[model samples]
Target: MARPTTLLACCKLYISESRNDAALRAIEQAARGGGGGAVVVNRFTDDAYNRVGYTLVAPLTPSPAPPPLRHAVLGMVRAALEAIDFGAHAGTHPRLGAVDHICFHPLAHASLRHVADLAGAVAADIGDELQVPTFLYGAAHREGRTLASIRRQLGYFKPNSSGDQWRGAPETDALPVAPDAGPERPPRSKGVVVVGATSWVDNYNVPVHTGDVEAARRIARAVSERGGGLPSVQAMGLAHGGGVVEVACNLLDPARVGAEQVQGMVERLAAGEGLSVGKGYFTDFSQDKIVDLYFRSAANTEG
Candidate 1:
């Protein structure tokens, strides 16, 4: 049968271990199963955060059986859950689980509903098979809940230890809200996972010259939409080692607000505090770029 042209799905997973290249390789290997042409668009590791992010893209064609893209993502999640032990995990990044966060984005002709369906499927598998607590966000949830709100309710932004480390295990056995899947009590080793489907978002970070995380936090709040700054933007301040702090931001609508605007805002905020802002960075490529790359790769493989 000829391959059907279809929408693209991008699965971005944030695993707890950044220093272990072997674990990353294991996840990648699992994602490449069944001869699926799932492309790894980006793989980033932050030692200070002790987290790794892998962005995988694949064509999502209708099938009688489970789709290859979905299978690939679940395989990777299983691999990550097995490799990472959140009980001993510690990092600057705030997380609620070993898998931490997994977000599915629609690219090309894909609809939000399409990705949301996939998110729901993954959540079910993670809950039923893996027995991990799973929360749904964005379009996946009927309430149109945001990831930030869920994280906030779960105390995800707070660190269990000084210098942003969550050690030994999550503090609470009971969640503020019952998870969409799995047991209500968080697992000791794996904790819980947040799965969502949302429109394309850009993860951008702006570095500041100062070492004061509190000042960075102030700047982050000042420039966030919640703080009455930019619209469709979520910002957080974090220490990135080396006497430097960063304003990590998620630009929900790049067309409405993008990395440039975020950089400008951070610069303006830093200047008022006698701090200098460094050039910002985008952790992943745009959705269009990722779709283009996937097709080019598919074409090459066909050739």
Candidate 2:
């Protein structure tokens, strides 16, 4: 969130207790480390009862003239958030939001209600603070709630005030999807954001260690739209904590796509390069507590 100059606005953020302290510490630590724009601390609606961060950065680019078409036509929501970045050339993860959509993962919280309340409260604050009208969504609150199921809600609301709860409609290469707010920002020439909450989507990543970075990148690229791969899957190649070139993907449905599939795909991609995935690793997928599949898996693993 500290990445400055390009962050026009922020929402749906994950600033944990440690993050807040680090941000506060960075205030004093800046001079000790380097300098400038290193700390930020703000009061949330109910300080004692909420855990959520909503940060939006304005893109620094030629606005809609650049790559808004890709998002508009391809239905790649993250690009809408990128449109507002004001500088996609220097941006973080791909996103789709004037305020990005947020799904709360219950880790520290005692109940889903706890996080939902925090999310709704945070959204309310953003609406009030930014003067950007918004609707809080989830099981707790009921204002402007979407009635459709997952299949129906995917494109329930457009970036320009169009409600397309049903799919298979002609995609809008560059249409204005009005914000949930009444007076939406005049389509930054690109598009807009659809922010809310939903069931936990799987966050799965795969790492390759064939020493062929470009080859891994190609596989990642193929897995993502930039190359054309899975449906409802956002993918990319990165060199990070993983010891090797990794093909990271956000699998929308763990049932259809899991660690096994990702491992399989990477192995197949590595064939031409004569390399293989170092290890099968999976993490950061949230499933409802009511669904005991993972809980049982955890038990079996322990057994």
Candidate 3:
């Protein structure tokens, strides 16, 4: 297979928790060896949420454009489901499954349509073979729905456990929204997965020096587009397992309102509550850095 001159695209797999080192290793090993002609470019693990984000890059050339981005993700998801149990999970981050969210992004040469089809195929395979319920969003859906809209229907924003945290699988066996693929009822051990394809999105988080989650939530709302803050910005305030709270944000349109804007807004909001703010950081690498990592990892694998 010939490598494309430009990095093709990336699929980000979000796992629920990282406490199980063996499970984490199994998933990472599967991703690295998935042989989908893809490379694992970055791995970001958050201890507070116990969530792990793995980004895999593929080549744009080579007729099929390396359909293995799906292959790689499928293997990782299988390993995750086999090793982890949603019923035994507890985290500050809201998640519905052992293998939670799967989002595909076009990096350099790949188009949204291409990754959308790929995401659909992966969702189908996961549903049919793995028997895991899957929901489609972004370009993966015929209507180009948003993930937040679907999550809202599933009651994902409410914390099922104490202290504004999510614990175990969802309480009900039935899902509010019928899955685009898979069985009607979500399994207790596996739960349901959300899969989608969209253009690049930035995952940025700003930490506040206080442990007051309510104050953080207020700041988060005031800084989010839904709350009439910046446009294309979604914010959530949550306890980060320390004497800290984070205003976790998804910058849907970073070019228009990026981290700088978010950081400034968070700082201003924290000041009102007499809370100090820490520097905000991104959970993943930049496109150029990811491409460089892909080249390096692909070469190592080829060698």
- lDDT agreement with native, every candidate: 0.87, 0.39, 0.89
Off by over 4 Å in 3: 1-7, 61-66
What's the true lDDT of residue 136 in model 3? 97
TM-score head-to-head 2 vs 3, winner: 3
Top-lDDT structure, candidate number: 3
The ten-residue window of minimal lDDT in model 3 covers 1-10
Q: What lDDT would candidate 1 get against the real structure?
A: 0.87
Candidate 2 Cα outliers beyond 4 Å, as residue runs: 1-21, 24-92, 95-101, 104-124, 131-178, 182-194, 210-214, 224-232, 241-243, 285-303
- Count backbone clashes in candidate 2: 31
Each prediction's RMSD over C-alphas, in Å, is 1.9, 16.3, 1.7
- 91-144 per-residue lDDT for model 3 (tens digits): 898888889999999886778987898899999989999998999999999998
Model 2 Cα displacement at 267 (Å)?
1.9
Cα displacement (angstroms), candidate 2, residue 82, comes to 21
C-alpha root-mean-square deviation, candidate 1 = 1.9
Instruction: Give the candidates in order of TM-score, highest first.
Output: 3, 1, 2
lDDT tens digits, residues 1-303, model 1? 133457788989888889877888888888777466677777888998898888988877776767667788788889988887788888888988989999999887788999999999989989988899899999999898999999999988887898545665776687889999988888788889999999998999999998899999999998899999999999999988899999999999989998999999899999999999899999888777877777777787788
Q: Tell me model 3's lDDT, rounded to 2 decimals.
A: 0.89
Rank candidates, lDDT, best first: 3, 1, 2
